[model samples]
Target: MKVDGEVTTGLGKAAYFLSQEFYTKEFEKNLGFIPYPGTLNVIVSDEYLDEINEIKCNCENLIKPDEGFGAVRYIEAKLNDVIVGAIVFPAKTTHDENYLEFIAECKLRDELDLKDGDIVSLEF
Candidate 1:
């Protein structure tokens, strides 16, 4: 399955959660690399909300959070048809259904030379 979304700025909060040792360790173990200490925020088109939810539902690699933190679920995907990454959904996110969070071994924005309003596609 594939989903496309527009690049958008995030709330500047993902780094806090991603940088935690708990999450970084799990990411390294489950994802085979320690993700960069942040996420690439993308806003999906409304028409694809169902597909996004389906992807969320199919996630099996769940990361249970530490005390006072929310769990995250993710599925492996390819970004821009090349880079391996994971699309993540955090239970405590401020985003609605239209948003998808991507985590990769490196900063995706820099890796892809992306900026706000750029369109990116993810394939699973």
Candidate 2:
């Protein structure tokens, strides 16, 4: 399964959640890699709305956040054909339905050399 989205600027605030000791430990334990201290935001395409929604609805028990944190679920996804997939979910975010967030083993910005306004492909 896969979804599509473009790189978008976030509020520069994922570190708040990603850096928490509780979440980081779980992320490393479940997601098979130590996530970087932040996430990459993407504005998903409209065509995949139902798919993303399905993921949200049925993705519980996979890697949900512990108590005191916002809800989350994860699936592996590849970025730009790299043999990597990010764990994606929503938090106490202001993003709309089109927006998705990602966490991975390495810094996505550095791995892909991406910049704002880049057209990137995220696949699972």
True lDDT of residue 1, candidate 1: 82
**What tens-digit string does per-residue lDDT give for candidate 2 at 1-124?**
6666788888877878778776778777776777888888888778888977887777753545668778667777777777474646765667788887877878888888888888777776
True-vs-predicted CA distance for residue 19, candidate 1, Å: 0.3
TM-score versus the correct structure, for each prediction: 0.95, 0.86
Error of 2 at 59 (Å): 0.7
Cα distance off (Å), candidate 1, residue 123: 0.8
Predict model 2's lDDT versus the native: 0.75
lDDT of each: 0.90, 0.75
Among these predicted structures, which one has the highest lDDT?
A: 1
Residue 59 deviation, candidate 1, in Å? Answer: 1.9
